[model samples]
Target: MKKTSILNKLRSSGLRPTKQRVEIAKLLFNRDKTFHFTVESLGKHLAKKTTTKFALATIYNTVHAFKKAGHLSEVHLRGKNNTTYFDTNISNHHHFYDSETSELIDINDNEIKFDKIPKAPNGKTIKNLEVIINLKN
Candidate 1:
């Protein structure tokens, strides 16, 4: 993503285009494929690319803000460890998680099928649906 476009996106999202934020945005959107990262991992990657040492809280807050602004998606994991990962691809999809390698592979929405889906109770319908298939040896 170009600097101008990134700045526009931030502005549209009600985020100030600070130096650190601009740098972070560049690293995030200037890619050919979607990126999945945790706060710690993103901080480490940013440290290598730039001189400023971003605090964990800053990265955490920024990531959450981006998600709130609909720029990224959060993948909720339910397991013993329950580690959360952020994804740049916000479109509806599923994932295959390798427990041994701590890896998450994208599963397109068309790849899965459910023979029977339970009916929603009352007026509360299924707003969001996500499936995580855990992999094992």
Candidate 2:
């Protein structure tokens, strides 16, 4: 991502384009593909690849901020650790989680069909639906 575009995105997301945020955005949006990452793993990558150093708390804050801005999505799967994985793809979709390998594969939006949706409570509307299918070999 170019500097101008990154700055614009930060501004649009109501985030101040700080040095650390810029670097983090570059690390995130530089590629065309989507991915999932944890705060610890992202911090390690930044430490090895970039000259700039960011604290773990900084990474957490940036991740949450991006999620709030709709640039990232939270993924949940069945696991003992229950570690969090933030996905770069914010589009509507489902996931297939492999319990053996701990891999998450995106199920396209058209792949699944919802025959029936339970009615929401009064005065509330359904915002989104998340389906995670567990798989094992």
The numbered model that scores best in TM-score is 1
lDDT of 1 by residue, 27-111 (tens): 8878978888877778989999998878788788778878888888988875345667988888999998887877778898899
- Looking at model 1, residue 17 earns an lDDT score of 85
Q: What local lDDT does model 2 show for residue 13?
A: 71
Candidate 1: which pairs clash? none
Deviation (Å) of 67 in candidate 1 = 0.4
Q: What is the TM-score of each candidate against the true structure?
A: 0.89, 0.85
Worst 10 residues of 2 by lDDT: 74-83
Give the alpha-carbon lDDT of every model: 0.82, 0.83
Error of 2 at 67 (Å): 1.2
Model 1 accuracy (lDDT, Cα): 0.82
lDDT of 2 by residue, 41-133 (tens): 789889988899798888898888888888888886545457788888889988988878767888888999989989999999998888999
